[model samples]
Target chain A: MASSPQLGFTTASGLEQDLAKLIVDSLRLEVAPGDIDPAAPLFGDGLGLDSIDMLEIALAVSKRYAVELRSENRAALASLRALAAHIAQQRTS
Target chain B: MMRSTDSQMAPVPTARRAFAPVAAPAYPLVAHDSPGCTLAWRRDRMHSVEEFLRSVWGLAAQLPPKRYAINVCKDRYLFAVGFAAALVARHISLLPTCRAEEPLRRLAERYSDAYVLTDHDLDTSMPSFHVTDHARHSSGSMKIPFIPADRIAAIAFTSGSSGFPQAHAKSWGSLVLGAKALGRQFALSSSPPRTAVGTVPAQHMYGLETTIMLPLQWGWSLHAGNSILPADIRTDLERLGSPAWLMTTPFHLKAYLSERTALPGLEGIVSATMPLTRSAAQEAEHIWQVPVHEIYGCTEGGMLASRRTADGDAWTLCHELRMRQESGGTWVKGGHVGAWLQLTDRITLRNRREFLLLGPNYDLVKVAGKRASLAALNAALLRVRGVSDGTFYWPDQGRSGNGRLSAFVVAPGVSRAAILADLRRFIPVYFVTALPRNATGKLPHEQLETFAEQVRHSGQARTIHECRRESFETEARRGFSQGARRDE
Candidate 1:
């Protein structure tokens, strides 16, 4: 589901947006989609999610994308832009 | 009798000095023959160490070449045997996973020919190599190979509480060093009581180091069973004899203390997993008359710091491991700190040598632009009278534009208003919501979302019990009204 094309979204961007929406939906964040900075921290200050939230997100991501989200990696935090890039890379390769 | 008195009473100081040889800094699993101590499994099963090792080695030889083995058994002997087998076979051992399936699949993907070595009873569909009864093999001294200490011994999975578990590769030397530091810090050898037992799973870092590794490395005998039931713990200690140490988690320790069982002789107790509350620590010590050693560590960083309750509040870092807080308030650089071992916890560094954890780093929530720690919120909730256990969860933002927190509590006697009043002391009114608990006393995260959905649809603030009643009434009324309409 493309929410909007003007969001400058590639297929990966669309996927990341969808995933971000899913995370927000699952965690029940009070913020709007427009408020979430793609590059801002989802864990600490920006989104303020805890380890349990991360675990829930990880499981959800794994079940949805068949991708393993390792907790110990910096890649775990990279930009929604980078996540989009990664998803695009995964999909293409 | 005069000659005996002359020899026996000849200044007791001389005899004490004679017995006190310079105690070498011993590693955790190195000490074996303590006075009145033998591996309980050996005594019960009638198998000596040499005999046990040979049998374990025999099993190792039977396995196919270069097979990766994962050991998940809670039994000390089985864990030891499997670890020895993996080493002897030069096969990689996969440490236990916190959440299975996805992580196991990832490991399977990496090590294509990996075989899980489990106890005979576990029904794993994956290709598994069963550990045979070691007693059946011949009685001979085990010729354990001198593998390089730096060799990647095993991969322990981090309990990634919010995501897929990550694997932390541990070298034998690093793990041994960490265990040695732990044993020393806890005074495993020099103390009055030398025995160590664990209630936590030995696969976890805290249990692995304190319970399994310390015994194997330092030669301290470990209790066979790993169960944490107070009765079982007391029984195991009595069976092992006095001056025993119980390695357990805050969860089990709290439960044990709550049960208020008459504890047997314990030299000390070591707690990990979650932070041990000061009140809990005091209660355990006061009730059991044993020192509670609080250990702080994670899979990525093997053994970080430990504090004996007798020594006061601060935790001293292990010998080799060092801690320095990053400018951003996270502790970094420990013994096993890998390339990306950034902690998920916040800590206040008193100095390089000691620090205090400030709870989960990511638990801070901004309500109407005001920052509040979720840990503080949950702690506040638990402080309320009659509130047993509670967790604050965020509601799905798509339906509700506000990212307010929803709470699931196991407060039996407390009313919703009372709980809200308690929360209101520290939190804003808009941040609170209600969620349901399943039968097992765990709030299924999905169910919380459903509760949130019900709240959103109904546009009402209903307690979990009230919501259930409303749903029941709605169903009953629909059934009756539909029947009357059809009859007319």
Candidate 2:
């Protein structure tokens, strides 16, 4: 289990939980959000997502947090945990 | 028979005139102080067409001698001139059928030392030439060497949705003549004030001709890059100013119209690549307050026809080409008489100059010896209640045995039973198979081929019921998990 942060629901784990669900819903993922391991890849082997899915997720993230996601950068951080962190950083900034 | 040596080296007078720049009084052709094609990268520095060509030539001269080169730039000016320079330097330009990695690799193997021309710096193993640099200079205008009019100048690759990407060669003289016909037909002589803004890549036929070739041969300004998003398109159009024409596809046009945002002034919108639905065209015209012109062309024939309105069925053939259907219900023609070409489309010729295309010939499929059109099947699928966008994909098992068709659909609120119920009305029980569509509303041919191979090896007839059952279950689990996460 990942360590929980000080703010209770504001922790990275909490953020990942919310984000995983959001991504799953937006892309119509075949697996449960909980079943999506935070560290596992969101594309290819782990989630079987493609470029179109990436575009959708990028649009969803942009709409939700008012943050723009560059497609070229997405390949490096296509994981639930990384996405959550990116979103959280944007929210704070 | 002593073949005249002059025929090989002599420039066909008619063909030479075809390559001449059209005289446009409104947009006068002016010389730039800078050299090469300048892509507006920043506010201060813009690359010139002359300079861009020089850079490409400089790079090509330095690289090891190669037979073929493939350009993948979205920019028309860069792609056209880059291609021209390569041909002028006596190298072949291989246009691959698909941009997919596997097909690209295969094509690369077929053509030795093939280089990919791109605008942005790409970190790949393939040899690449970047024309973005402004410093490079090319040699002076040597007399245009005469290659046979039928000599292959550029090879265009197809979008391999159904199978492996196939290569189609376009000759210099033939391509030039085709552009001349298009320019004359569209009255490009008047210099339509509308700067060309393309939503599709110049790598494709429609984009290559309308956006790139038109500008190069006719001197119309073209937008520098591919604008995919609706907002980006709007921004680019506004920046280009009045009398702007959008060269785009049906897919992007649908999305653009759906955004419902105030668009800039437009002279016209050219659509191709996929069939444009009547509803989509009407909505676009309504939204933009301009005519949505439909271009009926493919990778093989280049620009064939253009219709001003979506409902308009008759397509005016390009000035030089004549259309006649063979006795076997296939479109066959010989005018312009460059290459013997057979089209994959079924067209109805109203006369010598006009015709109405009835979709692609291959789009028709046979199930249990009963022929059914895939276009009709997919059209029925879209008509289902709550279905937003859908495409039908024939599964691998359907190749050998008596296999039914399968479809992949995207419907937000529609249930599986509701969709099945709707489909059952049009298609027979045996005809309906499994439909699996990818996110982009396109099926990967590789995946289908793999599935076919698996079926052939296993010797199992997978029922449509099994496929649909799995699809429904997957959708349900996805929906449930998504709902649960959102609730938390």
lDDT score at residue B280, model 1, on the 0-100 scale: 84
Please report the candidate that would top lDDT against the real structure.
Answer: 1
Q: Once superposed on the true structure, which residue ranges of model 1 sit more than 4 Å away at CA?
A: A1-93, B1-37, B40-47, B98-110, B139-141, B159-162, B190-193, B309-312, B334-341, B360-488
| TM-score of chain A, predicted model 2, versus the true chain A, to 2 decimals | 0.81
- Tens digits of per-residue lDDT, candidate 1, B1-488, equal 00000011223476587776443222222334432334434324423455555666577777767667877765676776777677656677787643245545666777787877765565446677666454346753354344445556687875343323457777666777777778778766733335667876667777777777777666566666754545556566666654678888765676567556556767788887656768888889999888898887777887778876545667777766666656675655645453435666667778777876653223545342333445555666666677667676665451122455556566776444555534422222222333477886655557867765665566455444454444457556555332111000
TM-score of each: 0.57, 0.64
What would the DockQ be for model 2? 0.10
lDDT for position B475 in model 2: 62
lDDT of each: 0.60, 0.59
